[model samples]
Target: MPLPDIKPGRLSACQYADNFSDAHPPLTHVQALIEAERCYYCFDAPCINACPTGIDIPSFIRRISEDNLRGAAKAILEANVFGGMCARVCPTEVLCEQACVRNTNEDKPVEIGLLQRHATDAYFGSPGAPMFKRAESTGKRVAVVGAGPAGLSCAHRAAMLGHEVTLFESRTKPGGLNEYGLASYKTVDGFAQKEIEWLLSVGGIEIRYGQSLGQQVVLNGLQAQYDAVFLGIGLGGVNALGLASETAPGVGNAIEFIAGLRQAGDYATVPVGRRVVVIGGGMTAVDAAVQSRKLGAQEVTIVYRRDQPRMPASNYEQEWAQHNGVTIRTWSVLKALDTTLGHVQGATFAEVHDINGRLEMTGKHWELAADNVLKAIGQTLLLADPTATTLALRSGRIAVDDEGRTSWEKVWAGGDCSFGGRDLTVEAVEHGKIAAYSIDRALGFARHDTASKRTRPTPA
Candidate 1:
């Protein structure tokens, strides 16, 4: 393909080491304590309402103020088991932090995400015991597909409720996006695997790796074999740009590229171009652009068809990318890729204007030099055979009710593969938790457990 521009070893060892350090380093003990004091702990806290998992924000902050790290972790985890990972990746500036009452009075919200991270990190660092005890065995078996946030969360909650869980994962490791899709800087120090290991310490959950849906695992067989089946099978396919040159050698999926970077032993081993262009308007695009810069790419540009307000990524994420030297070109659409011998060399883009409320491209077009291109456009759900599965689907994903129950009996689904999924880690965790209780009820198990009182998913 003659792609010489994309090469590894672009930076020195020190530069590589510095580039991948924790994107947001942990708060010091004093910093966390001080941040905890900033909270008013209102009785009707808006922050709690903003949390997708409905975590008790004021109560957790109160626990932190009392110097009870474990207690604080408990309050957070009872609602969201993946609190550690969420604290690292969740869009807090728009969610909980934005909803803080202090934002109204002082224009500064208490650092809830950082405080939660502070407590969760301490507990995970020396998590000797699981917080919740397993109830008497219910003899109910749950087959959870996809070991990403949703499936793993479902598995842990089911196990905690005294049900045996077989977690089916397509890849060798668990923590789907956490392990494979998240930016390296956002989750440094192998935190994804560490969180998963601590979650598995609860017992009664077995993970079957390399077990992909429709390949090694099938829905019909799972329904017959298990008491309840929870499908967290995340979006397996990356959406493609319809342009012809998108197939060039230098072009790639942003998620796949990020996954390779995440799995690589050393940052220097991953190849990056001197000038790279990414196409999309979401967190995946932002991650790809920022990581490309960190990997020593001289120039990185993110081109989105829509303007700033319509971007799926939070305003904080957009600013983060810009801070990392990424050029965000809004109202721009990718026109074509310039290729040399089947290898990408550059891209052409068109500026669009909202005419009659529709984005119609202007006649002028411009080109940017590049050797690498990434498409973070979005993802798609892949069912083994769309016709073979009787489960109802909506908007190209499995349809589910509030409890995550699908139309099919003995089956529930959540995560990005399900309709109404917010594509946020916290929301996915809540989906698993709610579905676990629903599964518990469907199995005719005793409903005297404390988790029955857990809150439902809410708007961010």
Candidate 2:
């Protein structure tokens, strides 16, 4: 067995700088104006229906067209507190843009995502007073665990409704997945932190960093201290490759790699293998593979157990990976790792087939040469002590009702850690928003008569 050839400075300084730049550059004012005019501003827009956060897509675009940048930003942020971040990271091509009416006449839809970024960036660039103000103090306090989209959304909304919010975060900096899990290129220039600061400007919300749920703070303690508790602690456990090389020197979780890349002061200081192999088919896999290539990996491959259509990553993301020179090998299940001297050199996989809707290995085996292997199969929720709380679970996720009320009273959950929703940032924001509304009602805040008017299908 030999040691892996993993080290920093795989790419030159200039290459590293270019490779890690923003994946989607913000549109110039003129470009944004032209794109905004492309929107028809339909009275009954399907794009709004497609948005997970129910952002008034047409209204925002209309404002953009009218050069009402601040108003457009307000429209978007009023619905989704994380509008700017989502505009950069969301798979709008499959969601809002896919449902756009313009897709009927022209194959392409309006650039809703870019338009969104234009509006939000304009507002954030030249910030004014906070868009929304907190209500009079209600003398009620809430504890929000996790600083990801869901928790932040919940905290912001609850605070706006006059509840004091103490947001608990495990890491030194906030923005859980947005800050750590996403590819560095997707959120270039420290946008996640900027968005967090913007959201916090509404006031009445306090963040306690270096505080994790299972460790520094416990569920029981939070319940006793706060009038209500909202858990947005996203999946904290990474799925293993279940192979002997899982802990090999060159083998690591893709999330950790991305987080390191995000936190790296200099991109050239981050180590990347010349040949990298990533397992799984979700956004994490694509992100790791693409970033690996950008980090100067000569050959990068993403191996998925199922076919392309079944991939958790959207078609746009898959295409983006391929465009960036990432090889996509589907119908392959990881079987073993070829290791030497406690380091991963490559991986062995068995070609699989769908038989009666169940994946079965066909006994056909192959290998991909690699100096690094990233496990991006999935993530799991790691509760500090399940017995410490009586919250019910569904398929290992916290089970909550439509409004995010958990089995335990005075407790709510949302985001990836909760049941019944996709792991998209926008979906998590909606969950947090709805959960806050529910919590507000429980705490004697008058419910809007139109609260029942909004509806969205629960994500399975």
RMSD of each: 1.9, 1.4
lDDT of 1 by residue, 1-460 (tens): 3554898999999999999999899999999999999999898898987898888999989999999999999999988999999999999998899999998889999999999999999999988766878887988899999899999999999998899999998889999999999999999999999998888988999989999788787888898999999999889888879987788788999999999999999999999998889999899999999999999999999999998888898899999999999998888888888886678888889989999899998888888988899999999988884333778988889988888889989999988898885799888898898889889988987573433554444434
Report the Cα lDDT for candidate 2. 0.90
TM-score, one value per model: 0.96, 0.97
Model 1 lDDT on a 0 to 1 scale: 0.89
In candidate 2 the C-alpha lDDT for residue 244 amounts to 62
List the global CA lDDT of all models: 0.89, 0.90
Residue 391, candidate 2: C-alpha displacement in angstroms: 1.4
